[model samples]
Target: MRILVRVLKLLVFIMLINHLIACSWYAVGINDLEREDTWVKANDLKGKGTVYAYTTALHWSITQFTPASMEVVPMNELERSFTIVVIVSAMVIFSSFISTITNAMTQLRNLNSERNAELVKLRCFFSDHKVSASLVARISSCIHQSNKLTGSRVHSEGVSILELLPVSLKCDLAEEVFAPTLCAHPFILTWSEYYSRESKRLFLAARSSSLGAKHELFNTGQVAESMYFLSSGAMVYVRGDTRPARVSPGQWLAEPAFWIKWKHVGHASSTGKNCELVSLHCETAIRILSQDASTISGARRYAKTFAAYFDKQFDQLSDVWADVEVLQAMVSEAFIKHEKELLRHSVASRVVKDTKMPGLLRRMTSRFSGVSMASRLSSEEGMSQDEQINLILHERVRKYGVDGQKRREILGTRSMGSDSSDEVLAPVVSPVFRNPERRQSIGRGRFARNGLNVVPGIASAFRIMTR
Candidate 1:
């Protein structure tokens, strides 16, 4: 670029000099050839005789100089001087143009060489690292995308490869793998609405499975590389001897990694009958999330919604088998299991802790029917970390069997209530439990009113359990 600028400046200077010379010649009558013209004409004579003498003298003059008496000039000599000026101007323009082209060509050659060198370095890096085939495929995709944007390949006539390297790499490796089957995967489509165009592009780059094939999206105890979404057919997911959970079409399974980094807790196999899946590589997902803050927030919201759904589902499942007597037990077990699952994820603590106190308390009452220290003191909000810790410690002490009597005596109030039948505080059940519809109606009312409000019946039940 600098070279081009310098060439332009030289061209301008040459043109300026030519212009000045032409102007001076015009002003001084250097190329003028009339009988009245000065500079080259004879001055002592007049008319035709002087013109003939000037012309004859020019042909015979050995010194190439006019006589002192010359007052007129011939046309041929004036035309020759004008032609010489035109030739000089043309040569200046031609030379400047040629020089500019040569400099441009040289610079292009240098850029091409530099680009090749960078590509070679990338190749060496890939070879030295023994990169996986999948990664190589992604790199090739990035190169192809770069070429498309520039309308030419890196080695062919195109823009500088370096200039588009960032964009090409940013295009997402998943695009290459998923391009052919993007629309076929339901899982990608399901989350597609939550993402931006760039995020969608990342999804498009994901690896996709062939239609009507059975594949293991996750293997028990293995770190998951990608998350799979079923677009057609169903996936059978099994964890241990527990019943195999069938993941139907339009459902995806990658929640374990969403909240926390953990190995696959279960294995999923496509049912082999017209099943198609879209798989998003975890690395690509992470990259996309990092680039978009809104997406991160959206992801957290989704996770919370999922958690709530799971909790509610668990409660419903418990209700299927439990009577009033075992309801408390069932609820306790459910809470413990749910809490354990949530805490396994590093993100679980962050999410669970960030919920507003009133909302969190309400969710605890409705979902687990028990107050957990992790949920109650989770938010740091206005309190210091130490205060949170102290609050948790105090709660634990009050709940301890050995210290319960002493705590109640010191507080001069019944901390554990009047119940002795139950060792742990059971969820507060509505007074209308005897009537299913009324109980449900009251429960909904309480849910809407306050999450932490205690039910008189539940408190009475706790009193009975303690007794």
Candidate 2:
């Protein structure tokens, strides 16, 4: 059908061109009418009178033989009418052709644009998909190996710890820590079985460093080849000799800017207290993370979540680390599984009476929910060393049990009251369970105390889970 339409259009265009050419030829022939009076006078025509009379009679007869009335019309008037009709017809045809061409061109442009956009979107989608798939595969492989190790009688707890530690740190502590924590997790068991036959092994170890020690700091101006996780003491983050901030045990350094070739923007120095640190090289970490697409995707997702949590906690910890009220608020709000439900139920009317609450609560609830969900997923799937460390610091406060809570209380109080030390260290507790029901109840109770209700989406998610 399309081909036939194109053929018809082409034929019409050719016919129009031929008609125009014929019109042009006729116009050239008519130009001689202007010079007719100059060549011969009307009175000096006695010899040609009879011939002229015959010629005029023949012309009249020919004109009278036409379909319409043969009244003699002025040549100029007839010519003018013919020219106007031809011009109007030509204009109509030209306009129709132009409009058709314009519409077709517009459709073609739109199609091309859509195709290009789809291509771009497809490329990005596939890239992410592939990464996600690879990560899953690597994790699966690691799990399989862990299972085999578990089958063996060797202590698997150490292997598990090794799997969690970064490559550089693993090499440093293989003899001391990695061999002991092999059976703690399934991942550990798998790793042990895989490396049991090998003579060389990897592990992580920490040693205390003297305060004000002139230890080499990773140059922030250069690309970070490794990341450091402080196990004990403190390290000062400096910008050219000026101490901007101090990182203590359980805190991590190094931004996840390696994917885009990012360099550190500042320098770090040891605060010289008895400090223990675990360092992981960047290339090894990338290689490990990139082994599977799923793992990478999982890590990336978790990274965004971790960053949010860190930023929030960092803000609260800026002046003092011992503010108990701040600590409770941070801990309680860390997971959004409950808070969202409170907000959802609170807003009953379809029409919003309070405009500010909706937007503000929605954002806050999303951040809380998103971060907690990301962390839970990351822990289940396993993550890179830096990510694991950050997760432990931010989410593992409960590991220390009563002691941990006491330490947190002290830090909170100190933060609210005094600045005795440049850096403060405390173990953050990880929540016992991520059950939606439990979270919802907690969130609702908190909201009731504050005189707010849960939002709809959060309420829905929670209600569905509870049922």
**CA lDDT of each candidate?**
0.44, 0.39
Residue 53 deviation, candidate 2, in Å? 99
Query: Least lDDT summed over 10 consecutive residues: which range in candidate 1?
Result: 458-467
Candidate 2 local lDDT, 9-40, one digit each (tens): 86577565644534442343244555433112
> What does candidate 1's lDDT look like per residue over 199-246, in tens digits?
556754455453323545567767555666665677787876778888
Output the number of the TM-score-best candidate: 1
Error at 353, model 1, angstroms: 37
lDDT of 2 at 375: 61
- The parts of candidate 2 lying over 4 Å away from their true place are 1-212, 240-243, 257-260, 295-297, 303-467
Clashes of 2: 60
TM of each candidate vs. truth: 0.27, 0.25
